[model samples]
Target: MFTLKTATSFEETIKKSLFICHATPITSAEEALAFFQTYHQADATHNCWAFKLTQSYRFNDDGEPGGTAGRPILQAIEGQELVNVAVLVIRYFGGIKLGTGGLVRAYGGTAAKCLHQAEKEKIIPTTLIRCTATFSEMAMVKSRLWQEGVQLISEDFTENGVCWILSIPDEQLDVLSAVYTNITRGRIFEKIET
Candidate 1:
C-alpha cells in the first residue's frame, strides 16, 4: 500500500563475510526483480533477495540454502510491517563458510538493519470522483465537500457549469454524495467513484 520515496543501505559482518543490504520500496514484484537484477553484482558470492506486497511474496536464497538466507530476510521485512518493498542482501565471502544459522543471521540481520534505517510512509485508501456543479453553485458546492474531508483534485469550468474532480475516503462515499446533493439543492454534478 505504501512505498519508500528513497533507497537505503546498511552493512554488517557475519562470520568474517561482509553482508551489504540494499533496500527500496517498490509497488510490485516485477519492479523489485528488475531492481535486483540491475544492482546484482557478478562478483558477489551471493545476492539473496526478498519482497512482500500484500498477500503476494517471494524470496530467493540464491544458492545459499533452502530457507536460510532469503526466508529470514523476508521475516525481517514482515516483522517491521513493511509492504511494497524489496531487500537484496549481497554477501562477500571472506574465506569463511557461514552455516545455516550464520547465513540466516547475516542476511536477516542486514535486511533488518537496512530497513530500520530507511524512511517509511503510510498508505490511505481513497476514492476519486467527479462532481459537477452549476456555474452559480460552484463555490458553495466545492466548499462543503472540502469541509467534509474531501480532497479536491481539480476543477473545470464549462458551458454547463463547473465540474469538480475530487478524492474522498472510500468510507465517505455515500455521505459525500448525499451532502453534495443537499448543499447544491440538486444542482451539483454527478459522481463517479474510482
Candidate 2:
C-alpha cells in the first residue's frame, strides 16, 4: 500500500460545472471528518468525499446521483493502491446540467489527477515490541536492534535492567528476535504490543 506524502488539490471545469478535488493523508476517521469539515464548500452544489484506511472505507455522494460522485472517487484512490487517504470533491454548479456519467468522470478524474500529481510514499507495516535486558546486555541488544533497522522509541533504566520500546518492521521482527536472543544468550524477555 501507499499514501500521499502531502495534501494536494486539482480543479477543472466540466460542462461548465466547477469541480475541485482535495486529497489528504489521514490515519483515522476523525482526521478524515476534520478534513471534510475544513474543506467542504458551504455554498457549493455538492461536497462529495471518500476515504480508505486499511480495512475500513466510506464514501458520501453528497447531493449527486447515488453512486456518481463518491464511488468513483473511491475507485480513483483504490486504482492507485492508496490507503490512509481522504478525498473531497467540491462542486459549484454553473447552471449546465451534467448527466450522471459526466459527474462520475469529473469527480473521479479530478481525484485521480490530484493524487497522481502528489508525492507518495510506501506504507511500511510495523509492530511495537517492549523488551527488558540486563545492563550488561544493553549495549549488545541496542547494537543488534540498530543493525536490524529497528526504531528505538524509548528507553528506561531500572535498578534491575533496561526496558526498551522499539518499532520494528513486520518483515524484520523474526530476524530481530533471533538476533536479540542470540546476542543476549536467551536472557532477554520481549513482549509484543499491538
What lDDT does each candidate get?
0.84, 0.90
Question: Per-residue lDDT tens digits of candidate 1, residues 14-83?
Answer: 7689888999988788999998998898899999999988769999999998999999999998888888
Encode model 2's per-residue lDDT on 46-126: one tens digit a residue: 999999999899999998889999999999999999999999999999998889888889999999999999999999898
Worst 10 residues of 2 by lDDT: 185-194
Q: How many pairs in model 2 have backbone atoms within 3 A of each other, for residues 3 or more apart or on separate chains, i.e. clashes?
A: 0
- How far residue 93's Cα lies from its native spot in candidate 2, in Å, is 1.2
- Provide the lDDT at 92 for model 2: 93
